[model samples]
Target chain A: MNRRPVFLITMLCFGFAFFYIPILSMIVYSFNESRLATVWGGFSTKWYVSLFSNRQVIAALILSLKIALISATVATILGTMAGIALARFRKFRGRVLFSGLVTAPLIMPEVITGISSLMFFILLADWIGWPGQRGFTTVTLAHITFSMVFVTTVVQSRMVQADQAIEEAAMDLGSRPWQVLFDVTLPVIFPAIMSGWLLAFTISLDDVVITAFTTGPGATTLPLLIWSKVKLGVTPDVNALATLMVLVVGLGVVLAGILMSRADRRRDADARLAYQANE
Target chain B: MSKAYKTGWFDRKGWSDIIIGLPYVWLVALFLLPFLIVVAMSVATKTPTAPPFSFGGDYPLLNWEGYERVFSDGLYLRAFLTSVVNAAAAMLLCLIVGYPMALGLVRVAPAWRNILLMLVILPFWTSFLLRVYAWMGLMGKNSWFNKLLTDWWNFVVPVDWAVNSIPMMHTNFAVVLVMVYTYLPFMILPLYASLERLDTTLDEAALDLGSRPHQVFFDITLPQSVPGIIAGGMLVFIPAAGELVIPTLVGNSASPMIGRVISDEFNQARDWPMASAVAVALLVLMVVPTMLYSHFQAKSGGAK
Candidate 1:
């Protein structure tokens, strides 16, 4: 066990280097004045400037944000509901079916999901005359399908750990079911819901394969935009854009972790107080 | 109110449950119904005259032609094989690279654990497409990596390393590398979760009983961690098998994977039924292994 630390450190360093070097190279090359990705001439922020000014990149960012926000909200609501149903009412009929269908999107290949979704939408549009054409609506729908799975997993795990006694206590005290949920359950699981929403948002924002199959001609998301540009050749502008994304995502994760840890500490404090009171 | 009546499924209090159940009906309509449509479309005849490549008007049932084409075509079969090999290779690479890192993290000081875990998960937050693109810059013939290796070789070896070495870009190696890199966290996190839960006393006990470290690992640790390995393997293997983005970006057209072929069938080749057939086939292949693994795990009570 004592020898573990030295061996672990060496392995950790190797893993870190393997994962980080490629990313770090991209970041470093983003500042290079040379158009060539290999040879570095001098450092400059020209690529970042170019990236900011690129209309397509800007549009894609906006579109990606729109999709992420819309899908994350919708998926969170639905996923939370499903999670509650599964966690609270475990013996319900069709529970297995519902759970399987919901989680199937998680493991199903993206290409299959994308193509199937696209076909389904096109068929539905023809039949119902709604969601007229594949665009933001379809993209959001696809994103929600996958993102909801993550949200459900997060929410379900939290709900399982949640004490049922509190809700029962509230009900015993003459509170309505809705009131019990709102006052007792919702506040307890709110951090999990927030984490689920954030996770869903990130998944939606990062999706490319699903978006590519579902998105309309005019509605390009950031990943799709980046993919097309990358296909042509590596560009420093993309490097700049990617660097920005990496920073934003890193910050979001840190913030979420802080929020979760705070909630955990609060829960621990509440538990300790209750134990002392019982004694 | 009577207690039994109050707790009844159809009671007034259960109205909220009904409301909660409503959205899942919509989910089934959106997610499950679409898959059914794909299944139906696969069997239906594709009419060139139809606007969106009609699978016939009323009865869009099974079309053997699509299945036949996928099965009979050498190109499709080859791609399928390639996909299997590539995914397996990617899964192996992820395990080799990630297992140690995860083991290390679990053994590290508690203070540094969070930072290390965050670093492991950070790459996932970047736009997946951007991460794949970054590999292009790293693996390209004239890329920084190749240049750096060549420079290092010039310092040590007399021969030109760049010229002798096989180009990493646009090869199966590059595609697999990216796939492994992208999925390494998926492998590591689960392994770490399992490894962290492991009892150090068990290892110590084994050591006290005169077992070597390797013997202790193979006999106790590996078996205990089998569930994690299976889960991690499934997580990485399933998607990587059908991975489109990495292969499309980094892999050559000469040896496309089943995913790329399926995508091509839909987008460029205009063969929807064929794409659906391929999809179904791929699903069947994936489901078999998954089911078998679950069954074995269930029998052994190994999976939590």
Candidate 2:
């Protein structure tokens, strides 16, 4: 029976308050009637009305969703492969370099990555001329580079925890390597892959600096639009937009959490039934 | 063997090789190759024409002006100084604020842990730009939040020291404050991960020997969580140092951060070579801590 100290509990409360107050304030202020972000006017839904009609914001939101979806899917596939290679393969050619490449983006400053990525695209265009303009294609590619690193981390950690015996067992039963992968290894790490995809999706949607560098000529993402607006000053409609984003992303996360926990509970039940059958 | 089976002969080895090689190739080209290009561009001269920079132009093939300017110019030097000082402040503040929280999380009951962890990450799922914008609203002069803080300051301090607002917006204080808010989760998560794995029995045993909690903490718990501290510190420091949005939104332009300067050099000045040089310099600055973190990771991975 350990007595948890009051001081630590106080810090815990303070930490969560610090994290939430700005957000709670933003959401509350979004309903204000006044144009000023800080001042409270009588409650009004006018900003939300304006936000819905804003053509630029709507276009940017659509563009951002498209980029996030494409980048997240591609990043997840590549990241799963990279994660498996790291966790399952004992050794491989250029493993250190591969590992470094996978993890480095997680820590590398955005300014550095942005500058380099932009230059790479330019050089790439000059050489191959495939991605002709710096727009949707370019931004999606840039998002994939850093976003995949997050996917790699999530999948790699999950892969490490997964039991390899099941995979080996499948292989021993005359299943080909790909069959074992699809049947055993993939299923086991599927939760990690799903969460990793979500993380990558969120990162891509939230990005600004890399998107700014890589995008051009009317391919503004939501964050890029928000950045330009916020740069000038805080507007009432921006607050409304922020509140909506928080709602959508928060809902997605909660939904994912429920599904994962439910899946886990079912697995536990199945394992218990299997044990009883053996007895 | 049937002829059809010949294609499957190299299926295991070759297929796995391709599976592994695909990501490796994509990264080397996208991540590694781009980095090399930045290094090469750092040595190229700025031009007024398209591509924005070239080697062996009217000037020497290996132009060192960008690197030279980075070291010699007052703006670059001051920007670097601002970045380091601000990043260091944010890193330490995050540690101060995050350490106790992480410890509290570890000490809590097991059934509550997962839920609390999810709460910690929930904010991070939201757009980062919005979070900074929230601060912008809170810190603005006319805002209710600002008035509350200003009123408290006037009551605490002498009457003559009072001001209309606390001058929070467009200051280094604002930059650091927003950063501490933004990066606190990064600090807490790693610290939690490390502290959670610590042997709790060790704390209980030390307490059994009549060692005070603080003494036990400093001697036992603190040492164990040092790795967590470093991991969190690097995560906070490296990004905060080069952050663009938070600083640009909340920070003063007269004395800008390195990231703002890089953007200006690249966009406003149309000097890709200079931006690349500053980026290369930033990478060189970051490489040491980056390597230390990776080395720690490799060691821990190997031990596992």
Candidate 3:
């Protein structure tokens, strides 16, 4: 290798270490049998055991999972519909407005989003009888607003890559529009739907700011619980919780990647077989 | 059957379009309506000592008091300036740290690339608050690493500079350090995507002519990567300006930033009008840079 490559590699290694060391240290310290998180007081799973018995941590974890699942599923469905409309229909009157509305959450400051949603929910509750006393319902709604944008982007890109000719052919072969959609478009975009669902799930799971605004006293998510606890002081149990979360999220990501790669391989194989048949 | 196949928005035969259109309507109602409410609330005067705050009156649309107070107050102005400055510094730090990592990842072997990319994004999967707490533990005064540093330095040297210089917590430096770490991947990923798409032949051609490596980089690579830089900078800058968590967690309350000011107005002072004014000011400050970045992105044909 050239000297340039060596220099670049060294520089990059330093950068990576700067980013990774603190996080890696947190993971390591979680297993240490010390009340003070910084000290290496022998290896033990005491904190993990304590974390398991902590009611606050357990409740927050369960609530966070429920919020993530519900919001991700809802957002994925809504976003897929929006993506199909945007891709298939071109000359809508409010197209620009709709596009702006969809992307606004992606760029707007979270503080602004949080404050605005809080204000809206308060006012809505005052006027209407629905969504009484903001809590999990409001938090899930806020998450869906933002997470749907990610899902829409993913699904739209996938929809663009799909061949519309197949749908046209299905229609010509005596299939109704709904049947053609079910038989052709749905199957083709299923992978995108899965990816979109995963993206929404992760985004909702990781959200803290918006969830903070909308959550009432009894509805703390894991991140919210961690945040309030940190304000007082650090605890070893939080570290153990963080370690478990990192493991779960990391596993989900790895599994999703494996499944996506498998799908891509199958698609490639099918394409090759189709070409062979034509020859 | 062909006559019934009219695919327009108003055509009733395609009822699926109505279902598809519902999400857009929900977005507008839930997302856009609240934003409009914010705009409305910003301009409306707050009633003195009331349960239900009302914006009703003859001149409901105009409240110069909020805007005037925000501009006239030195503390608010200074906070705004500090936020802009801090965001700029954080952006510069992210570029210095992230660009090289992006370059390395793209050039590395295929087998290592996936794992390396995972490392870059791993932080993003965890709760942002936990990551901040992790940094707090690592950088605290009685932290194990800091203790080790002090002990080692005391043995080797008589000077206490190492111990004194190590900030355990509650400093501007701590806030900036964490901000850089938090946003580093955001900066790196976009630049990496751009760099990966760049043709190697362009660099070869430049070298084939009599261009030095430095010249080729500045002329060919830097210009091409401008879009990535702008995109990444906007990602870091806009949020950093309004960020309340890192500064509140690590820095002193005396450190002026827009986020702290707005938060104080809401929580500590219970002054909604002041908070709204500060929020409006922050939004106004962000608008110019956002428009400029969008224009640049359009010119470069990058994703908006």
Candidate 4:
């Protein structure tokens, strides 16, 4: 037991060092005053201040956030509906197709998805001219397509494990089907929905390949900007940007972790109270 | 319970129908239709038109020329091989590194488990591109990290065998390193999920039955975690195989991966049909392993 724990701790330390060293260096260098990224100079916050003033990066950030938000919300709704249909309406016609479509995106590589969608958009525009040009709308649509699968998988798994008796009891008490869904089913699966939304949001935000293909001129994203900059040459401003993003995501995770632990404690307390009442 | 109340105004069947139909319609339009376009374009001949390909008017509806080109061209074959090799290496490395951490996660005190798991997931919240870029900073020829590695190497090797800096950037080593760093979490989380569920009594029984600790792990823990291994392998392998950014930023341009080939063929060469052909073939290649994974999954699930 003693030996095992030592080995485990050593492994975790090494693994975490491998993961964090790169990120830590990036964050540290972001504060460097040197224009050269690798060279260390006295610490300064000028790069971060410059990052905000850089209209291109700022525009791309806003665009990415908007796309992530809208696509995640839409994907969540559509995916939850699909999840409910899959879990509750098992014997429906086209069930196989429905299931297949839901799982297909999981395995499909982003490159293939990207090229195919780009072609599809081009052909669609040629056919109808409805979207005339590819930009935010096309990027958002592409995001929604890929992200909905994650949402569906999350929601469906939760839905399958959901207590059906509560929903049935609600229905038996003269509640309509919609009422049972809104009042019972939705509440039970709410956590899954929220997680699904988060997953979709993150996926959309991090996406480069799919967005690279689907996006047109003026639809540049943060990843795209970073990619171009890295290709041209690494710069200090990118380091600053990377650091800020790390801080934002780190804060978000900490907040989420705290909330999750609190929620778990509350649930435990509620269960304990009910147990004592029974005694 | 009272008799089931019939819906007087609203039809449950109708609502269910709409709910089911929405995703079906959306997927068919966006997902299915787009894939069909690629398949169609793969058969079309390149043209001077805006979309750069045409299927109708004198040209035959189907042309196997693109497919023929892909098979004959050594570039595509080499790229596919590189992708598979790199992805497999990355997957194996991730497993080697992640398994212990995951095992540790399962063995830790229950109160600390969630906090530890959060630590594993924390780095993932950061931008993946940024993380890869960080590797670029570390692996560059003039960087302090490279200097440290080179200094260590010089100490180990003969004086005559010493060099200034190991060419880490634009090499397979850089690609694999970044990939392992990026996908290690994918490997650990799944492994942890399964390892946590393992019945410790089985391990203890093996230990008591005269098996060594290593023997018990091989005979018990390793066999049990095969499913996690496979899931993690797939999760890492699939993306790593199709990965464009990692290879583009860090990898040697001489031996481009399939992703770069597709991107280059489309964006640089303007060979849309050829790119489509390669993309389709790549999809076909990926599907075989994915299907094998599914088969293994089904077998394991059935056993359970």
Where model 1 places Cα greater than 4 Å from the true spot, the runs are A1-5, A259-279, B1-20, B51-61, B150-165
The DockQ value obtained for model 2 is 0.59
DockQ of 4: 0.62
Instruction: Give the range where candidate 1 chain B is weakest over 10 consecutive residues by summed lDDT.
Output: B3-12
- TM-score per model over all chains: 0.93, 0.94, 0.92, 0.96
Which one wins on TM-score? 4
| Candidates in descending TM-score order | 4, 2, 1, 3
How far does residue B119 in candidate 2 sit from its true spot (Å)? 1.6
Interface RMSD of each: 2.6, 3.6, 2.8, 2.6
Considering summed lDDT, which 10 consecutive residues are worst modelled in model 4 chain A? A84-93
User: fnat, candidate 3?
Assistant: 0.50
lDDT of each structure?
Answer: 0.82, 0.87, 0.80, 0.87
Ranking by lDDT: 4, 2, 1, 3
The DockQ-based order of candidates, best leading, equals: 4, 1, 2, 3
Candidate 2 ranges beyond 4 A from true positions: A1-4, B1-11, B57-60, B293-304
Model 2 residue B259 lDDT?
Answer: 91
Write the residue-wise lDDT of candidate 1 on B119-231 in tens digits. 99888877788778888888776775877776776778756443544478889988999998899999999999898999989999999999887788789887777777878
lDDT of 1 by residue, A1-279 (tens): 456568768988999988888888888888989888667889999989888888888898898999999999999988888877777774667878888876788888999999999888877888898778789988998888888878888888898898777766667677776787688788888988998998999899888898999988799988888888888888888888878877888888899789878978998999999999999
Question: Could you give candidate 4's per-residue lDDT for residues B170-205 as a string of tens digits?
Answer: 998899999999999999998998898899999889
Second chain TM-score, each model? 0.88, 0.91, 0.86, 0.93
Better of 2 and 4 by TM-score: 4
